[model samples]
Target: MTVTPPPSRSAGRVATAVERASSALGRLRRGRLLHPAGRSFVGETVIWGTPGPPSGVALLDQPGRYRTTVRLSKGTPTPGSWPDVLGLALRLHHDDGRPFDLLVSSSGAAPGLRNLPLPRRRFTGTYSTITCYRAGRRRLWLAVLADPDSVDLGRSLATAVAATRTDTPRLVLAVASAVGPWRLVGQVSLGAQLSAEEDAALAFDPVRNLPPELRVAGPLAWLRDQTYRGSRRARGATAQSGGSTATTV
Candidate 1:
């Protein structure tokens, strides 16, 4: 049997430093360091199963529908008409009632560029996982593409909020290998808007909330977990001052 070695002491030290810095920033901001301001909505996710090769994730291999909560935000607080990295976070419930969180950000759709975040003027652009997820022996990436039938969303956060007020926003959920084309696997339809308090109280951690078949591995996952732990701890400490401490899913 093949065994993976543990991270080196130097790597561990760097991860620790990253956790500490992230914790401090989370405390300073009293919320998310990136994507502080966002809009949340009640949504539904429908899986159609991929038409191409099996993704190895049962959720995407079989057809299913689930209730979901979605959050859309900008990575950097850019003003009106300015381009900024957009974020899309989805929270879904597993069959056994555990939360499955999936977070993606505006990024390239091509092979070499998929991991790179790209500033987008509109919320209708593509959003990528940025990191690959392990599905058995294979690694795959996920993405969300705006449905062509959906209304055209503008550049500003306010515009997106306002547009969703009147129109139901729809997105296509797709998956692919590192250098493969995206294959449609599901659809996401967002409905009613969530209150500011509700939005603020929502916290997403993909590292902890994923399914067994689809694992987030590697040193990057370790770093991500630490960062998320630090942020959650810092925010929990000051939860009473702002949003509720209760995490929805």
Candidate 2:
């Protein structure tokens, strides 16, 4: 049996701070603290083995296709076409019927910058997990990049919403070691937009919804878990439902 260590005092303090901040922000906004506004889509994820070493997580090491619900949002409520840190929240069902959520934000793809969030005016940029996940004894990072062949939609929320009206948007999923180049793992194709009510009811929690093989550990994970709990509490929302009724195209 493996015993997990308790979080450090400093980690506890940081978690508390993050929780309080997220709660306050959510209350002030009367909804989500971070991605206050967003468009939701029904989609699918197609996964396959990468070229490099396996991530040790069965989901990434094997081939699979899963239904997904995705949300695209601006981190800050930046007005109109202004640049803002973008966010992507993806929810899918594992083979065992558990829901797995992955939250990503606009970030760099290169080493030394992959963990840093960057503002963008278009939806066609890189989005990263911004934190590490433990896959066995190795640390891994995940990213989603816009498919170069896809349309380069404009910055405004309206543009993104409108584009989905006519066509589906696609993003390439990749994974990497602590400092290695990214290896292609899968693809996410977002289809029809979800209704406002459906979008409002959806809450993503990657920290709680992850698989056993891919553990979210350390201070950053603690902070994120607390922050997510606080946000949901302030908004009176619960974890995402495994059986989503949203319509897909």
Candidate 3:
């Protein structure tokens, strides 16, 4: 698949500058810049093959397990609270030394549900991105379906990584698209969780570590760099100010 190049270098620089300015303002008001104030955790999950026939997308072609780390946060930095937008950032490591990074925000799961006001949710709720991947000529989205009664379990998965200590709870990664209905594509099982400090230092950039097959498109893709770049600027400012440290959001 042919992926379009990112925004021009000049546009990127301008976006980065705007992001730095926003970080500066955040720093001035809060005394320290917290790019994203949300719960973070690490786990292990398998990206199972799509049900039925092959999708023709090389990355979505088979059963694959990955060591995963997820940073869950709100769109607005609400302290210990959820809001209109839910940000779920994923980094997957494979056995062949390749890494897959995906950053998606929860808006609406279905095509008809697009742009509708999202209800408030906690750390335990399911998060999804609408139509993110390209499967040959088709577009699709991935969702992490969480159990209704699994709120505490979800939080626990983030705090510690011990595979739930009993039954290894499975989370489904469903792929959906405008052309077709949702399809079960992959599964994730948490093995270990990252420490709070490690989580704080983790950087989740879909662009930097993403696989070649999964490229973000549309206007949202252009704005993604501004976010990472701004968070980076904020981290630098915080370090220079001798305040608390952060890596990315």
Candidate 4:
């Protein structure tokens, strides 16, 4: 039919875009969200496994469709008080709009203090462009930047995503700007993964089981804060900056 030509081409374009997205997602869903090699620098590594994870843990609220790990220096993340022990590697796998599984690794980096509104760099922002899947029971975080300090959080989260991509192979971190909020969703555990006589050059004695200037806290507190508070409270859901709200949950 005369009208069929344009529609066919339009469908082709849509199909191509879908194929690209699918291919990328498939790779994300399959590979190691956090490579073991990248995590050699963390002080204490907590691995949240598939099919029954650690107790008091919400990640099991949903199934870990894909397995991965993230190493982070755990502590209370406030503005100006603490430092990012190491740059983190955060990789998430999406399965049907939920972040089915996630892997994140951390390494310490003194990004230096900034005078931003919230000292967000002192805190880490874990954000993603497209979150296709989430673990059931696990919380979702959406960060909306409205005040002076919040935008710094957005930038920090973006940096975390970028660092994660560089730590692994064939990994891509998607960053996009939407109208309402920027979201960070997942059930990835926090803390660092240790190795035998590790090689990354953080000169801490392993036997002490203590990392210098490093403290531990519950896993994924930031994510939990967003998942429970942000999504439910319209304020959290609609927290924004620059005439828009950016969310991470």
CA lDDT of each prediction against the hidden true structure: 0.79, 0.80, 0.54, 0.26
- Cα error, residue 230 of model 3, in Å, equals 2.5
Best candidate according to lDDT: 2
Tens digit of per-residue lDDT, candidate 2, span 1-249: 122324565755666777788889889888887688888888888887777777898888788888888889988869887899989888876656667799999998897888899998887888989988888798999899888887655687788878777887788888998789989899888888888878877888888787778887566776677778789878888876423554444
Which stretches of model 2 miss by more than 4 angstroms?
1-21, 241-243, 246-249
**Stretches of candidate 1 exceeding 4 Å from the true structure:** 1-6, 10-14, 237-249
Per-residue lDDT of 140-248 in model 4, one digit per residue for the tens? 2212112222222223333433444444212212211223222222233222233433322222111111112211122233232222222223211121111101111
Put down candidate 1 lDDT per residue, 72-114, tens digits, no spaces. Answer: 8988778776888889988876547556788899998888888
Q: Residue 171 of candidate 1: its Cα lDDT? A: 92
Q: What is the TM-score (0 to 1) of candidate 2?
A: 0.90
Span of 10 residues, lowest total lDDT, candidate 1: 238-247
Which of candidates 2 and 3 is the stronger one according to lDDT?
A: 2
Error of 3 at 26 (Å): 6.3
For 1-249, candidate 3 gives per-residue lDDT tens digits of 233435575765666676777667645654223335544555555656777766665556677666676655666655444344666666776556546666555556566763232545544455666436654576666667654433244332233233354444456666666546667777655433445566556665555455555666665555654555566555553211111122211
Query: What is the lDDT, from 0 to 100, of the residue 43 in candidate 3?
Result: 59
Residue 162 of model 2, lDDT score: 82
lDDT of 1: 0.79
Instruction: Check candidate 1 and list the clashing pairs.
Output: none
